[model samples]
Target: MDFEQGSINISDEVLKEIAFRSFLEVLELSADDKDAKKLKKNIEIERTPDDNVIVNVKTVAPYGKSLVEFGKKIMQNISENIQRMTELQVSAVNVSIIDVVEKIEPAEEEE
Candidate 1:
């Protein structure tokens, strides 16, 4: 983006942060989730010659969830959030499901 003064550039770290947060939102995981920190390391952002971004995300899908649906949700969420927040175009969102783990349910408190 450009202004009368100069152009605005967003750093890759910021873009990655945006993408990660959007990814977590779709998965309904909090930043404090046991795997959040490790999962964050799997997000990567690349810039294209056309000045658009391509996001590559690797994550473990919870068992019992449809992998296709899960990947679509993540791709849509990340693309929307990044474009909405940064006004940058997302060329593509590539999601890689690395593994599947059983869903962990929170324990209920005893009455």
Candidate 2:
């Protein structure tokens, strides 16, 4: 975007962060969760020639979840959040389900 004095720019790292957070939100996961921390490393953002962005995300879906519906949710959430927050166009959001795992419950703490 342009202004009288200068132009505003959003960095790639910022875009990636937005995408990662949106992914976690869709899964109802907290940022401090170990899974979320690992998932953060799997997000990538690429800028197009026209200043738009393409987001690629790799994740493991929880078993028994419908993969198609889950992927659609991730795409929609990431795209909307990025566009709403940065005012930048998202050309595409590509999601790759790398694996599927059963939900693991944390062990009860022993006092």
Candidate 3:
């Protein structure tokens, strides 16, 4: 799933969908991050001259293990999503975690 060229041309619509989907998936994985509890978020994508698509995902994670898990999810989702649109080999999916979300509060339970 490597885009040897470094970047691939995709429709604006596809890009938008990818961004949105990627963001949501990240959000779900980082649900425990208190800082990430903020409903508002954004994701940015850029194509490098070499043909590599750089996905800058801004979100929060529960730290440590959760962070790693979120990263794996990002790669899988992006790779699978791109494949669904076209058979282009994506050189790489670069994900940058911009914000570290605050820890989430545990839910209360009744006896």
- Give the best candidate by TM-score: 2
Residue 96 local lDDT, model 2: 89
What is candidate 1's local distance difference test score? Answer: 0.82
Score each candidate by Cα lDDT. 0.82, 0.83, 0.53
Residue-level lDDT tens digits of model 2 in 28-87: 878887645766767889999999999998776778989999999999999999999999
* Candidate 3: tens digits of C-alpha lDDT, residues 1-111: 337778655664566456556555655535454443332234455666765555555444555456777777877787677656666445556555544546522221000
* Candidate 2, superposed: residue stretches over 4 Å from native: 104-111
Error of 1 at 88 (Å): 0.6
Taking all chains together, each candidate's TM-score versus the true structure is: 0.86, 0.87, 0.53
**Model 3: how far residue 70 lies from native, Å:** 1.4
Every candidate's CA RMSD: 6.1, 5.4, 9.0
lDDT of 3: 0.53
Candidate 1 TM-score over all chains jointly:
0.86
Which parts of model 1 have CA positions greater than 4 angstroms off? 33-35, 104-111
